[model samples]
Target: MTDTHCTLDICTPDLVKARLAEAADTLRRLPSARLTAKLTAWPDVVQSAATAYGYEAAQTRPAAPSPEAISRMDETLGWLFWIENDGRRLLWARALGVPWRKLEDLDGRSHVTLKKQHDRLLGEIAQRLAGLPAAMH
Candidate 1:
């Protein structure tokens, strides 16, 4: 508990960060929500060759997460249920690697204060993970 410690499953600050990051990535890998929204149309004319005069612009959706990854993401997501709405949003945004400047703008809090809050929240989880809670049971 003196330093960061983890063996997967959100056991420490670093582990929490890494798992949250993976959860964020897993979320990004999900299919677009707009899939049901109808696209206006496909190209009027189709080119035989997959090329646009040698200037092809390729856009690929991120690969989908595996069943296992989805489960993990689900568990990771459940951990945030105890947090209040804005805290959850802030944590998720940070997990997605959002810049502190943007977070400051979003939370209307100073960068240092936000970081400290984040660390304290994560530390609470770390404490629970380390199981040093004689104070509780």
Candidate 2:
């Protein structure tokens, strides 16, 4: 089974999925050729229109992750799922919303090690999310 716990302030996977669906719907409503023409004909004007109106375009909350970005994240998560070591795999799993565990079988590792790995995985995920061009974090 997979976990779906909320670990931070960002929306959950389910919410992100819903947002992606909404974004798709929004894109479908527009006439692609006309939208493309407007964008291509006046790239600078279209990009700056929001800013010209005193809108802090970049500072505002970002839209949901782009389809490509979500695909990349899903791929990364799959990689995490296959970690060879149970302890390390468990740590990565926690980042993907898996519940925390005691890992009684991994005797060589202590509580401190588990906590450190969890924190490290989280830091890595945060960095990855920060670098994504269209991801919400």
* Index of the highest-lDDT prediction: 1
lDDT tens digits by residue: candidate 2, 4-96: 222345424343333333433434343457656787674565456667787773654344456754554554444343334653465443444
In candidate 1, residue 108 scores what lDDT?
Answer: 92
Best by TM-score: 1
lDDT of each: 0.73, 0.46
* Model 1: worst 10 consecutive residues (lDDT sum): 1-10
Task: Score every model by TM-score.
Answer: 0.73, 0.33
Runs off by more than 4 Å, candidate 1: 1-10, 36-54, 130-137
> What total of clashing residue pairs does each candidate reach?
0, 0
Q: Clash pairs of candidate 2? A: none
